[model samples]
Target: MTASRTTSAPSVDRLAPWGFAAFVEANTHDTAYRPPVVDGPVGPTIVRGGRELVNFASISFLDLERHLPVRRYFAEGALAHGLSTSGSRMTQGICRPHHVLEQTIARHTGKERAISFATGLLANIGFVHAMSSAAHFDAGIEVRNRDTVFVVDRDVHWSIWKGLEGLGYGRNVHAFRHNDVTDLARILGRDRSRKTVVIAESLYSADGTMGPIVEILDACDRHGAISMIDDANGFMVYGPENRPYAREAAAIRERADFVMVSLSKAVGLEGGAIAGPAAAVDAFELLSGTSMFTAAIQPPTAYAAERTIDVLAGTPEIVDDYLAHAARLRRQMHEAGTPTLPTESYMLSVPIGNDAVALQMREWFVEDGYLVPVFSYPAVARNQALLRLFPHAGHTEEQLDGFLRTLATYRQRLGL
Candidate 1:
């Protein structure tokens, strides 16, 4: 037998000098630093660096993450369902909690049916892919043509674009001016012969602006197009007195052919949902790529979300409190000469217009015991950086006052 020659494999350091590894290493310096580590559940207050910080970085608008009832539900759910689903819904992941949550979502959104996904981004991608695919059209819905066009809002979440791309309809996607109903109408008129889907977000995350959803839906109705609303940011924030589906535009919700929402935001849980006609939702459940591939949401999360909906429904005051706090923060910011971008949601965007200044302001806020995320390129257009603030119901008056005062000081010092 011949003796085998021993040889050492090349090290990662050698490979890191070229190709994708080198590119990533070189670009690491261009990215923002990792945020301070948190030690507990996210809420109005977060423990970081051994100190408590008033956290505006969280999207928990209702502060449900720290609510005793919500926490209790989470614990009970974990005890009952373990920690993981261990399989996709198409397999063995479907559970009683998931079905219950779907039913609650359907009832809450006034849709014929609802389906849940692992996350909001996945939900958007799956739903859009299903809606724009040939298989979905062949499943029974009448379509004018196989050539479908997606007229989407220019500022809709990237997930929407990704979904369209995944379905091979990227070239067919057209964008209207952000939140401009007239521009959307113009785009719809340009192609009345093609089967079109008009997409818009109920609340824009980056700019903290809301689209004219009702008008957009009306335009779709008139143009023989389907209207899809990504209500990820507005689902639990905007509505009659902060109640879900209670917006001044509530009457037009039914006019929208599809609605997608994120439970991680105001609901203080982790999951996404799509609400629509029973037939469409049923088809999406069977045909969407994510539905077939991604594991179902953890049972605990579904249980918590379902319980959250019940809590919100029973205690409307919670929603009212959140909206009230948001309004107060907006009002105070305006009074302090730091008005945010015009918005109707809980988020407030303070446009710094310069990336460097926004980052500096965020640092200053952190130093002053407040944590706020600075939105920069890709999240917003180039040079349109902003400090995004999420006002929550759990925030105390003192905390809000301190934050506003710090902001005012920073504005003066930085000449923003």
Candidate 2:
């Protein structure tokens, strides 16, 4: 072999920047345009950069984060158990509190068992990864990675897609139109040989719309497909009896083969859970890569979540009051001539259509001493930007009144 004429030194060519990273880097030079540094959530408002702004971005729908009892439970648990369990459930992350929380979730949802993950995103990704590959784990058929197909709603939460990221048959994934039972049936009908799993969110938080859950589940059953639901937005609010109070019932919780819940939302705490048949949930305990390799939730959060579930269980009237309050505010929005998407829950979006206009709307909110979340590209389709707002039960009368006035002013000036 001819002695390989090797170059002594490695070439030092700078790597080309990626699209979004380069875009973000170029834009960050504008100091005023960076993300707000929030101090923390206080009641219905947030303290940002030393100023308190009326907050519409918070998902603490029950306003339980400010509840003294919840706080006390969290504090007490932290003091007693220290902070983290410091290991994945496969290792030492397992703890008594985790078991209790899992039991609570299973009982509440009427599922056979439940699994807890560090976050809802993790829970979803892991559940999808593990459950889709599971053999007879309530799918009533054996499925390996190569034999399975995932049929997701077009607007299913991003984490579900992430879960299917590296699977062998991932390219086989098909998306049905959002909330379209006919479209879902067509897709489910196309392939019966492969094991199929249908995925959706019972509440599409971004659009402030409830999914056609009962219809979707009915279709899934008709086509011999299993269903997985992300109940992140509907939890603690949506239930059997016309939940989110008369808007729709979350029949998914009762009907889905699998369900994911984010404690970070209605519970106003940290952590996520996946509940299903005991065999399925147990298989994911080891098969769920996210939960197996990641540290379990902190003890304090588990304590807080448990307490919150109890408190919310006793107070179904709060859910009713919130929808009624949100309905009243939504009416005021119509009177203000602000163009809004048809929303069925306390969450609503003002369709802005253009990215720049939505960003400008955010600046206006900042200037008006309020903070609201806007969805643009990457969050939604291009030119389909919107200012998604939450009407919290905890917002004061003055705050609500001021928010409505600001929206009216913006509508008059920009016609958004």
Candidate 3:
């Protein structure tokens, strides 16, 4: 060639630090492949890459996303409210849709007031930060004095930990054993002089377990501590007569000082709300960093959430139907000798104990026209990986049977 061109290879060091690059490279070759893309609404069955698969990975418990009425409402809201809120609620984003959704959520949850956030994770973080450091942000007073303590359950979601750390109160946070009321009481007894706020979840998503919220709140009352329940997984799914609170809705509303709920799960929308007394809700609206800094939830999502609340209120049987389906599936799994954790809600988790096998089983499930996700290390303990299943109101008996049959065939390979 008369003319030759020389090009130097890109330097890896200039791209990323060695350790970071190595870590990413290792994960790329890891046994577990990341989730695939989906083309449409996530329901009992999902379309992935033009193939339909039995989907157990979705958290849309009621499948309202596919309901004709719900979809119509969503489309109407989109046309009416444009696309985005475009600003924070404190500034220019406050709209009619937001007010309606907030009022609906407050009424549905039986709280004095409710304030919406962009997501459940944001709601939890914002609520904890605002409540724990209210005085500081409001009147230049440090409410989290040396005597204040945050007694949190060990199994509480990571969002709770991030909240504490964000407020620089990580050192003041103490963790009690998971779902152990006795341990919580013991910890509370040791520091009765401090202003303590106890944090726990109503339903833990990972292990498929319900917290002893009644007992935990009672202990908080006896020890002069405030209690907060993150009911993201339990809201609208478990209640009186299998409605919302497992027959203890009234007690929970009365005893828990604060409750956080997610609209993305059973409510079948995309937002979250912190529900409690009017004073706390108002304070969070004013001082919560996330609320003040981030743009409010889109108007379409807010409107959809309001419509979802209306549907749930008008159709009580829907909740009962979901519970029935979940119970039937659990019974079938048990009868088939498949191990499942005892849970009060619709989540069913089967501990697989090995990360590689859990990853392998997920591949088998997908290949067999099913989509069930696996939770491995870093999400859980080192050896406590689990196959998480969510039974929805839209699932049919035939679908459940087919899923169970597939599991039976692969049970030995998964070491279940």
Candidate 4:
């Protein structure tokens, strides 16, 4: 009939435009999306349903929000500065505080310069696109399509994948096995001639595992690749001495490279930054989408971020408390037969194996006065779900005891 002469347009339903909705609905059943309201701070707590519960889901590891001085600074900054920047950085948004924050981060991280973005995702996306789009051709020598390879860790954050995808060079992208330096070496060896960019995170969110940054950086150097790491979760925890990335920042600058981190996590603020050589920072200024399109984060956020950095630098007690709490929590969970990711980081994940068990455990824990969520496939390993928790600096030993006791009760009920 079509061959004879009839022409028919495709139906809107045939396009499957709402496929994402159905997919989300089907996969989101076993995950509890709890939005607990924070009443006040008392060492890892939130007032839920008229009761204060031990909160193990907050990302403020250094207790920026709970710190009275920091809160006061933020409030005063908000009063002094307006709510929004109201214009893009390239236009009128580059204020004194934004530059101050950048300089503070640069000084703290031992980098030549630092460029800030509105959010973590924007920072990742902007970094990748900026590297790709910057004018590297100075002598009529065009950078070919497949000449630059984007080497990524298999378990990198989705925002990174989105950034590479947005670059539209899927075929040029290669993935190394997660934290497998051998495979990374193999991939880099294969592309010895091309300019490669190794993309990895300092600490993976899904498994709460640390990347072999020193090893990866060595591999990157061996293959003539640029080592670009996302230090979103590791920045505060791994200050200068403890972190390979931070310790190697000067060397990275010597070799002409960088690493990006989010201010929202341990910084307890709103934004991200790429710290490295001034050349790359200049390139970011010229080509980063966040710089070109989005307005800088509010002056108040910048002020808060700067203050957070000041606290991290000035006081070691906060970090010490956080580390001690994480160690105790891990020990308690392991003793309760709920093993966490193989690291000493504050982000803890208690594996439950089954989604139903995970959901039950999460709900039971929350009901029994512990606020932790069961992170599922999208956020972590599929089919191996776990209850994700964040023990902050404000958390006390008694709070830890309460959480452990509640988890023990739920573990008994579920026979876990």
User: Which candidate ranks first by lDDT, i.e. highest?
Assistant: 3
lDDT of all predictions, in order shown?
A: 0.80, 0.79, 0.81, 0.75
Q: Write the per-residue lDDT of candidate 1 for residues 1-416, one digit (tens) a residue.
A: 99999999878787755686655655442325544567977678889868788988788668665454777888899999888888777777478889999999888777888999999999999877776666535556543223678889988898988887733444577889888989988988877555688889888887877778778888988899988899888775555543533543483356788899899887878899899999889888766688778877888889999988877777667777777778788988898899688765678888899877887777777778998889988688888999888887788999998988888999999887
| Candidate 2 lDDT tens digits, 1-416 | 79988675533333344354466677732323575577865557888878898989888766764444887888987997778887667766478788889999998877999999989999998887786564444656555665578888888888987877766443568888888889989988887644788888878876887788888889888888888888888877777465543333446656788889999888888899999999978878878878888788898889778777877878777667777787888887888776678756778888888887877888888889888888887788998998898877788889989998987788678854
Greater lDDT among 3 and 4 belongs to: 3
Descending-lDDT candidate ranking: 3, 1, 2, 4
Best-performing candidate as measured by TM-score: 3
The alpha-carbon root-mean-square deviation between model 2 and the true structure, to one decimal in Å, is 5.6
Taking all chains together, each candidate's TM-score versus the true structure is 0.88, 0.89, 0.90, 0.85
Task: Kindly indicate the candidate among 1 and 3 with the higher TM-score.
Answer: 3
Models, CA RMSD each = 3.7, 5.6, 4.4, 6.7
lDDT of 3 by residue, 1-416 (tens): 57788889998788685576667667842334444567977788999878899989888778765453777777888899977887777767478898898888788777899899999899999887776663544566345544457889898898888988844344567889999999999888887455688999988887878888888988988998988899898777666554545544555667788889998898877889888899879878765678888877788888888988787877777778778788889899999999887665678998889887888888788889998878888888888889999887788889989999999889966456
Angstrom error at residue 205, model 3: 0.5
Q: Please give the range of 10 consecutive residues that has the lowest summed lDDT in model 1.
A: 27-36
Clashing pairs in 2: none
Instruction: Give me the runs in candidate 2 sitting further than 4 Å from their true place.
Output: 1-21, 28-33, 65-68, 133-143, 168-171, 240-250
Separate clash counts for every candidate:
2, 0, 7, 0
CA displacement after TM-score superposition, residue 71 of candidate 3 (Å): 1.9
